[model samples]
Target: MFLLIRISQQLINGLSIGSIYALIAIGYSLIYSILMFSNFAHSSFLLMGAYTGFYILILLSSSFPLSLLIAMLGSGILAVLIEKIAYKPIRDRGNPTLYFIIASMGISIFFENFIICTIGPRFRSYPRIMQTTFVELGKLNISVMDIYAAVVAIAFLLMLSYLIEKTKVGIAIRAASFDLEVVGLMGVNTNMLISIVFLIAGILAGLAGEFLGVKYTVYPQLGYITNKAYIAAVFGGLGNLKGAVLGSILLGLLEALITGFLSSAMRDIFVFCLLILVLLIKPSGLMGIQKQDKV
Candidate 1:
């Protein structure tokens, strides 16, 4: 009974954390599908999201839901600005992917340094808006915040899925993911689609950041931890949204099990090892479809 309870507890913890990873990974996959490059600056968006939520809660009110909404909108606008200022010009000039990479890195570094200089390097905790209550099921206890995060994440993901699957804009996004040029040739405005993608990605990043802040604490370097989300993105397949979600949940569960049964110090080593093994075995990822060059 004790062992079962422990396992259940770990599972709950894993799902809670995994939901955040999944959110971030979805954003990563979305951008990677269209841009064909990793946005290292994504962490900066998460940082902004966390700070936005923090200030909204502090200055405006302690309403968790309201703070989350504002954070998402604020981050979405910020992402649009980033795309316009940093990526749009290079993209319009038809620069190489390396340029995009360098620009992304520069943005990431600038935001990290900027936060450190302006916001200070100290960690800040969210006000206790939500009660740290627990729900009991049989012999297992689950945290209220964990349940809230997981449920909200799941709901948002479902909405995103619906948008992608059922909407006209979603169809354009899907087609663009396969081939942006082809999609544009088919009379689709690629720029508008890209903006929509960034907006969605930014919103997800904001939610993930706020949830992470609630679970842990907000700090300037907190976004650095999204390296785990990047790994999750790779594990799921760089361009596959569903795969990102699945991979994140699996990775989260794996981490939870390791932390529960072994030393926390070994968790990261195991994670990287798993990533290496996955790459070696399937470079295209579990659900990733590989394309071939035409002869």
Candidate 2:
């Protein structure tokens, strides 16, 4: 009975945590799709969103959902501006891809340091979260907040998928992802596409941040979780949206199982090992498409 209880707890814990990772991972995947570069600074936006949400929720007398909306918009606008000021110049120079990656790291460092300087180095707890203990089945237990996180994450992804699949903007996005020049020739505003993509990424990061704020506390270094999201995205498939989602779920389940049998301290290490092994065996990821290079 004790073992079963432990397993249940682990599974619940993993799903809840994994849902947050998946939320951020989807942002990582989408930005990669539009920008053709992996952004390190996007991670820092998670920190920004969480901190801002905390202030909005606790200090400003706003509700949780309202706080999330405002925070997401804030982050999204920041992302668009960052793309215009930082990435646009880099893209214009036709420099090597390595340069952009380095710049991304630089941006990440800037945001992180800025947060540290501005907010100090303490964790801030949520002001007014609705906490509940929910029990299900004869021998299972769960939290309402966990269910809320999972549902919100899943719904947002679906909405994104729909936008990408069923809208003109999405088509433009898809075209730009494949070849910006071609899309440009087709009269698509590449600049607009890039801005929108960054905006979308920012919004998703906010979702992750809100959950993290509730699950733990607001910290200036919340970008640390972005690393996990990036890993999950890569593990699933870098540019594949569906792949990133599945990868998050897979990592979540794996972490839960490991934590069940082993120690929580070893959970991340175990998952990283699994990621490495999976990459070694199948680099394309579970649902990623491989592009063919002509000889």
Name the top lDDT candidate.
1
RMSD of every candidate to native, in Å, equals 1.3, 1.8
Question: Candidate 2 lDDT (Cα, whole model)?
Answer: 0.83
Per-residue C-alpha lDDT of model 2 across residues 219-248, encoded as one tens digit per residue: 777788888878889999998888888888
Candidate 2 error regions (>4 Å): 1-5, 132-137
**Least accurate 10 contiguous residues by lDDT in model 2:** 128-137
- Candidate with top TM-score is 1
lDDT of model 1 at residue 195?
Answer: 94
- Compose the digit string of candidate 1's lDDT tens values, residues 168-236: 999999999888999999899999999999999999999988988877889988888678998999998
